[model samples]
Target: MDWREQQPYARKQGESFDVKYTGSCYCGAVKFKASSDPVDAKFCHCTGCQSLHGAPMQWAAIFHKKDILFDEDALDNINFYDSENKQNVRHLPCKISCKQCRSPIADEGRNMMLMFPVAFKIDRRNIPHAFKPTCHIFYGQRVADIKDGMPKFEGHKDHSNKIEE
Candidate 1:
């Protein structure tokens, strides 16, 4: 896999601050831009993430369904995989490349879409702010030596704290 970090770019900041984040696939055949900041960002140590990224963990930024815009043809070329029996997360790989070169571009399920920040073409600094791992699932499958410092919960957090809920 190709790994790279481009120079940081300027971004608007503060509550309500918004900016566009641009990204593309390895061959540049697939390109996209999200018009708003990510609602959530985190790293996953699940087996699916490991197998998809071929790494210890995978970094992602979650955006609302409406914020994402992409080339229709390129979007159709995306390859998807239902990695687990739970069928809660769908992996989207670049279709222009072989398995060895295939890279995850997003994860769609649970009514949300997570874009892999590493594939973005924008400056790293312009990327959305990320939050701590709110929770960790499938802990039993995690590496024994991996330290668990973030909050641990069976699933997503309860939004009862929100007044609207």
Candidate 2:
């Protein structure tokens, strides 16, 4: 299916509120607006994230699918990749070049879309409040030893009180 075909259900809803944040891709080929406060902002240490960002972890912000706004022309160049397991998640990255200079713009994933905060034209300090990293996965592959201060769990945890039948 196409990226537009796989658009999330939440995006169809009428907006109850609105906020704004600006984002762009690596080469500045893309530019866009996020119209809501991210629900869950954190870092992922999974191998896929590590490989994509060329870093030990990837910073991500989760938003309802409908909140993303982009230039119509930029939409054509989005590149999609199904990483690890196609059954579960996919990554959709933009392939546009900046209007003034050729630079790649941005990328989004199945559950989250990440934009480099440093790329925005405004003062970085005025950016939205960011929370502490909630949980870290792939602890085994972490570049350095896990620190002693943070809470560490053996595997994924379900905090919901609802018991499955």
Candidate 3:
């Protein structure tokens, strides 16, 4: 299926952000920018996220879809993978990554983009002051445990903490 079909969020228009952040892939073949601040930042322990990112959890900064911009030349360097398994398709991320170097770029969901703040061109040590992981989502799916003490939510941290049966 076309990747756009996997995007549940309709592309927003006319929104703007004063502050812009830029990022690139490991090989520098892919680059992008985002505007405004994050709606929320969190650690996602969902199996799909962990598998796509090859990490225990993904640190993501949420932004309105319109706020993200990719350069023209780097357009072809990006690709999407549908992370849908058995759950509703609308609920999973359409994982975006760099084709050349294979860096996990963003997790696109309905209405927003969950990006890796580590990709932002900012000082690494300033991460906490810049973006903070407010909660942990899909903690039940985690392969490993982190003692971060952040509120662990079973479904979506903001929407519901109850585990889905």
Candidate 4:
């Protein structure tokens, strides 16, 4: 099975699961709803992520763009910043944040959006198994060492060397 297939939320053919997540910015100016299970979840230790999030790592849940629905206020309350290419922001991948509070939201890719799990309203003790991070990516760039047993990839999962503990 593919690495992603191991995720609890990875449904097989003809199988179905229903889960929803609601979240908003710190100031509550930007709200969103994810009506489906995430495609994947992981702890990212990339330098860009650390710098942008102001932390050593970032936990993000991946979802199809269509699965995420922004509230009507999003049009005016959200801002997109393309850290790689600034010329055509909307046409390329970018980071989405609240215009008022500047809270980091999601990283918008071509088809997937990596939503910051911290923004969601979830019970800390009852987080769903599927929402738990499965691995660490960009481990080589990490500023802090994580001794968790989860797979640690020096770069992108499946595309880079796995760091053995």
Measured against the true structure, the TM-scores of the candidates, in listed sequence, are 0.61, 0.60, 0.77, 0.85
State each model's C-alpha RMSD to the native: 10.5, 7.1, 5.3, 7.8
lDDT of 2: 0.49
In the predicted model 4, the residue pairs found to clash are: none
lDDT of 2 by residue, 1-165 (tens): 555444431233464425376666555455566676666555555676576667886555556556666544555544444443442223444212354443433345544555444444446556557523455555444565556454333322233221121
What's the CA error at residue 138 for candidate 1, in Å? Answer: 4.5
Tens digit of per-residue lDDT, candidate 3, span 65-96: 77777665776787767666643233445777
Q: Local distance difference test, per candidate?
A: 0.53, 0.49, 0.72, 0.81
Runs of candidate 1 exceeding 4 Å displacement: 1-19, 84-101, 125-127, 130-140, 144-165
How displaced is residue 109 in candidate 4, in Å?
A: 0.8
Best by lDDT: 4
Which regions in candidate 3 have their CA more than 4 angstroms from the true location?
A: 1-19, 85-93, 128-130, 162-165
Candidate 4 on 1-165: residue-level lDDT in tens? 541242221345664434488888999998887878788999999999999888999999999876777765565777878787764244447788888999998888877889988888888788877689999999999998899899999999999999996
Q: Model 1 TM-score?
A: 0.61
Least accurate stretch of 10 residues (summed lDDT) in model 1?
A: 1-10
Quick one: RMSD of model 2? 7.1
Report the C-alpha displacement of residue 14, candidate 3, in angstroms.
11
Question: 74 in model 2: Cα distance from truth in Å?
Answer: 0.9
